[model samples]
Target: MSTSLGRGLACSALAIAAASTAPAEVPRVATDIAPVHGLAARVMDGLGTPDLVVTPGASPHEYAMRPSEARALQEADAVFWIGAELEPWLEESIGALATDARVVELLDVEGITTLEFREGATFEGHDHEHGDDAGHDHDHDAGDHPGHEDEAEGDHAHAEDDHADGDHGSDHAEGAAHVESQGDGAHADHAVDEDHDHAGHSHEGIDPHAWLDPGNAGIWLDVIAEELSALDPENAQTYRDNAAAGREEIAAAVADVEETLSAAGGVGFVVFHDAYHYFENRFGISAAGAISLSDASDPSPARIEEVQETIRDLGVACIYSEPQFSQSLVATVSDGTEARAAVIDPLGFELETGPGFYPALIRSIGESIAGCASS
Candidate 1:
């Protein structure tokens, strides 16, 4: 085990020791991602700490558990994560489990409604879906919520196209051959292509990365509290109290960002990716459009043209790029728009340090936009 994993385990051990006098070994709680780690840390404050699968600065999309992390998962009394969909790689490991790992997925447990990757909602999407999935309020259906279904349909179509165009075809040649032999391969391919065009071209909605919304952060904290209490009934009060405090802190931080941004008269910015719907919705700011769709994918000429047009039309003041994304992409996009470029660290991609890290994250975003707006 690396020293970090060893320290995490040791911390868990110490947390367990400080809380319990029972002969039974302390429950080892393990978390799958950094955001989950943020919630778990609060829930476990003064109780036993949980093990985090992804380190502080790793990308969640490509995370692979180390042996020590797997061991932590194996020994864990419970495991918490954002969701299987968000972390597709963890599905096999989690699904093939032998023991009762007591997984508390915040996307499921927190009762927050989920949205697809890209949505057809707004210039900067709203936060209605990201909070309080307490009822059967699933507006994910196509006509049910105006543009939502179309956006989802668009994503579905894009996925179908990617599959048909052999983006992943070489890896699944046998499947491709079977489809081709069945005479449905070409038909399937056509259907997928049509869907992709519709979705990608419609471009009528906000990107649904709701976890970026701090208001939804409240839901996650609530879910974490419930799970911690269930796991350690003895310290349920402590867990609940700690979670309440964390919730208040995060909420206050979000409010501060809102106040700051409101005072700045709603800054107009551009982003490398359309991951700002949740953030923009809360502060009533704007990100003209993304420089790209998938962070790893390159933008086509037409897409770049659209960004240039949006920048001109919206009077975009700054183009904000994330840490892992190409700064060059932002620079290229900004060249046509005549917009200045700013860098924002999303924290899931960086080693965030301090209890005020989440707060600092939100403030940093506000400050970046505010700076551009003022300039």
Candidate 2:
């Protein structure tokens, strides 16, 4: 070959080798809630931290996007949210704002176990058919209460129905195919149903509090790792390794919380709103009832009367308020009653925002409940 031809071949070979070893492009990711962002942060540990759309102290139920947040979404290569059921406002905006981004609704991701909103109910036992199937035997017998077994069974069945209606199979392809076969309106209508009403609050369908269950969080770690790895193929193993480590940590934290709350297992408590069902159920703690359905609204007089009656009738031990809402309602309900009042931060608003936030959030919940119930 001539000198010029040999030089051209050498340059081409160098280009090919460089292209072969180049690292995958890291996608800019945006996440909806703090806890969800916490999980994504773990998966993206060495890659990059995902931007959080909703800030601390803001309720996802009624968050309006700021201009900067909108810009973040527009710039994101991938957007991870729970689903329309959790943030209905995002239903239209995500498609319009983050049109170029790959939208992964963690709640719709296959292998994520979900729970339905318990209508007019408080935290019960961990008997619901979601999350890890490790059977927990509770000494707090609901059988002694009249009609408790029937009511509990009915609630469990409702939760199962909600899960089935969503058609969340273990196989991602099958689940996506099933969703597609249902037609476009199917998903929207299903979300409408799930977001429509809760406790006494007007909102969308099933309880979107799946993250409160550490088992669900463990599953989320895998899903997040898979999605991040797909986006950045060069860091696939790193993502998986982080997920494995994170999952082990979550499992350990969950076990520790369970053990700590075991002493308060049978103690009945009430909350400011109906958000902790997942946490309470996960640890086998039973709440008497909630003061209101949504933190954004005040309890109706009749509802207040009903909760007061529940507290009086059930002899509830504690009434817990959340950091995001007013404590006056909790005090009102607990006034003249023997119940002690305490606060629980379900969203980790008071904790530092990051990977540690999620585990701390769970630990805080367990400790608060145990403290109030044991007192």
The TM-scores of all predictions, comma-separated, are 0.69, 0.75
Which prediction has the highest lDDT against the true structure?
2
TM-score of structure candidate 2: 0.75
lDDT of 1 by residue, 1-375 (tens): 899999999999999987786633446777765555666666666555567665555544445444445555556677767665455556556554315666755554323444445542114443334333423233223221111111110000000000111122222223221112222211211112212432122232323344566655555565556665666677777766766677677767777777777777855677776666666655656565677654434667677777777788878778888875557777777786668887775544443532334555667777777777777
Question: Against the true structure, whose TM-score is highest?
Answer: 2
Tens digits of per-residue lDDT for model 2 on 325-345? 667778788877888888987
Colliding residue pairs in candidate 1: 120-205, 121-205, 142-149
Where does model 1 exceed 4 Å of error? 1-26, 116-208, 348-355
Stretches of model 2 off by over 4 angstroms after superposition:
1-22, 121-127, 131-204
lDDT of 1: 0.55
What is the lDDT, from 0 to 100, of the residue 254 in candidate 2?
Answer: 76
